[model samples]
Target: MTQLETAMAILMKVFDTYAAGEGKPDTLTKGEAKTLLEKELPGLLKAAKNQEEVDKMLKGLDFNGDSEVDFSEFVVLVAALTCACHNRCVKK
Candidate 1:
């Protein structure tokens, strides 16, 4: 696989691994999302201004107001973070 292909595969794998924790295999419940962030992206959590900021960020992930994040929504989060980081690095 190419570099981008490997990244895409890992994204799906990470989402699947967390989304499988409870409720449904296709979506992540609030708890599962939190655990995924806490475990998979601890630095993001730490960079938040506070717990409420972290909570607000997670709450904003639900675009359909379903309270659960689907794969597409999760991808948005990853893509946004990737853009933010890439821009930050390029600025320096």
Candidate 2:
């Protein structure tokens, strides 16, 4: 599978862990995913004060400008956030 697909799989795993079996994986609606990102991923998306901003932030990361950021975009942004966090830790 492609890198984006891999990232989507990983994202699914993350969500599954968060939801704690309260919901089905296939039935994970966009709002639920958005909620996860907005509430849980504050470090990765600092300016995401709300779900719409979170959605726009994700959209902005779409390098191909296809109006859809798949797993690749998601993973790359997460990786960048991870690196940034690590660097900050080192600096401190």
Best by TM-score: 1
Q: How displaced is residue 22 in candidate 1, in Å? A: 0.5
TM-score of 1: 0.94
Model 2, 22-69: lDDT tens digits are 354433234544555666785655765776776776556667775544
List where candidate 1 sits over 4 angstroms from the true fold.
none
Q: Give the least accurate 10-residue stretch of model 1, judged by summed lDDT.
A: 83-92
Error of 2 at 87 (Å): 0.3
56 Cα displacement, candidate 1 (Å): 0.8
Clashing pairs for predicted structure model 2, backbone only = 4-72
Give the number of the best model, judged by lDDT. Answer: 1
What is the C-alpha local distance difference test score of each model? 0.93, 0.61
